[model samples]
Target chain A: MRMDKEVVNPIIDTILGSITSGLNSLQASMEPYLPELSWVAYLAFAIYVLIILAGGFMSILCRNLVRAMMGLVLTFLGVAGMYLLLASPFLAFMQLLIYVGAVCVLIFFAIMLTRNVSDGEEAHWPTLGALGYGLLALLAPLGVIGPLIIMHAGKIPVQVPVENPTGELGEGLLSDYVLPFELISIILLVAMAGAVYLAFRGFGPEKSKRHSK
Target chain B: MTTLTFFLLASLLLLAIGLAGLITRRTLVGMLISVELMLNGAGLSIVAAYKSTAASDVLGQLATLFVMGLAAAEATLVLAMILVVHRRFGKVTTKEISLLR
Candidate 1:
């Protein structure tokens, strides 16, 4: 009778272990696959993406050079918005200050400086053939690579709320990333010097002769 | 799709558009703008990754800062070079500036 009891208990425990694992698997699979996005949040995301799409379209497909530059500005703004949504407000501000205020201005300066060549009748719209080819080129990689990524997209991790990324960013910048930051500064100086040298050299005697055509 | 995946896909689309533009654009300035689009896509992806995977970490944001700096430097030098190109070649199309040919 004791032997019979021991044997039956071992069998029962084995059955319970398997059942528990099966239930665990079921629970894991049922873990909320739906992201907690409301309709409003979804709409906001769609609008931001649309803004980026419009900007990209204008930048690439527009006939007018000025319009293309405006599109670039729009794209920058949309990216800044995206950064804000991603919880990096400082990055959003930096994107605005740097891309919109500085880079676009510099680009406009270059455009004006080379207006005779860059801003002329060559501003005509891209041909349908070109657009078709561009679209084909655009879709090829997405077709080949996108499916595999989707298959393995996996579950999204829980997001941690970060209160002050800026302060942390500053601390990390000064401590761990100080060297790279200094190097970037040096590179900026070099780029500035080089740009000035190139731009100010201008239509000099030797070069103007070559551009006479 | 979830928000994270949506952002990733959007960034990917931007990258694809940039690639297409780079391939089809014959003009120097247009190509530069396309490259800028690609850089923007990269930064967005980095920021998104930080948001989704490592929300507690600031390293991704730091990387993005460096990316921005590099992009700025690239744009400056390229625009300067474009200016010089216009001065030398009388045109800004890629077909004209192929010195190797």
Candidate 2:
């Protein structure tokens, strides 16, 4: 492994060097207009948007369920970056820990458990007719109407964003939103119990014995 | 476009994509994934709304926290239900499990 890494390291370094150099050249060329670290934020935002779009499209259109889950994971990560851009690092971390970490793993497990069930089912890719219908059904109307509304609507005046609201968020959760906070815990507990029960409801001793015969 | 506008538009797009997926997906798990996308869109829009309209208010962050909690719970329950359905019906696709019809 060490020898392989030694051989591959130079190639990886060369690729990375070229990419960074290319970006630097592009930034230098655009320096007069963009001029500073602001463009980096925009670049990051654009990358996140691309990830979201690609991941969402892949999740919807992919034939493989596991690949679809991976796409969903990408969407989660992109949304976490969006949260960071929105000045909420706490929620961004939660998005990473819960959505990408926990939820995606859970979905992966479900995919593994149910693999045989989906094998011979109507699990094919959407045909061109279905794709066209889906586009017409949702995308066309939303695409046409969404821009019209946004263009006509008066913009909400932007305020100076809070630099860090996580502390205030905690205080509010403890004081103003305490009830809902506690309720969420209870809901999670109930869900956990319910899920376990639902999954193993029929695996009683007698049923297991019957199946064994 | 302004950051606020960009987020709103992106969230709207996410919603439309999610809904389209929900309509077009053939598997129960795929539908669950679509619902998650819709929820993320809702969370982003909420945070963006609060960021632009009420920068100091912690309500938006709190609401998003609640959303994440609910999403975790929903994923748990839905995946479990999917397992049950697969066990009982021996299939996990939408078209194959129609017992009533």
Give all candidates' CA lDDT scores.
0.78, 0.81
Q: What C-alpha lDDT, on a 0 to 100 scale, does residue A15 get in candidate 2? A: 99
Off by over 4 Å in 1: A1-31, A116-121, A126-129, A155-163, A202-213
Task: Report the C-alpha lDDT of model 1 over A1-213, residue by residue, as the tens digit.
Answer: 356887899899999889878766664664576355444455677788999999988877765666777898888888898887777899989899888888787677766666733456346656789778899878976786667556657565646324364788999989998999899999999999999898888645867675575
Q: What DockQ score does model 1 reach against the true complex?
A: 0.43
- Number of clashes found in candidate 2: 0
| TM-score of each model's chain B | 0.91, 0.91
Ten contiguous residues minimizing lDDT sum, candidate 2 chain A = A116-125
The number of residue pairs in model 1 that clash at the backbone is 0
Give Cα distance to truth, residue B62, candidate 2, Å. Answer: 0.8
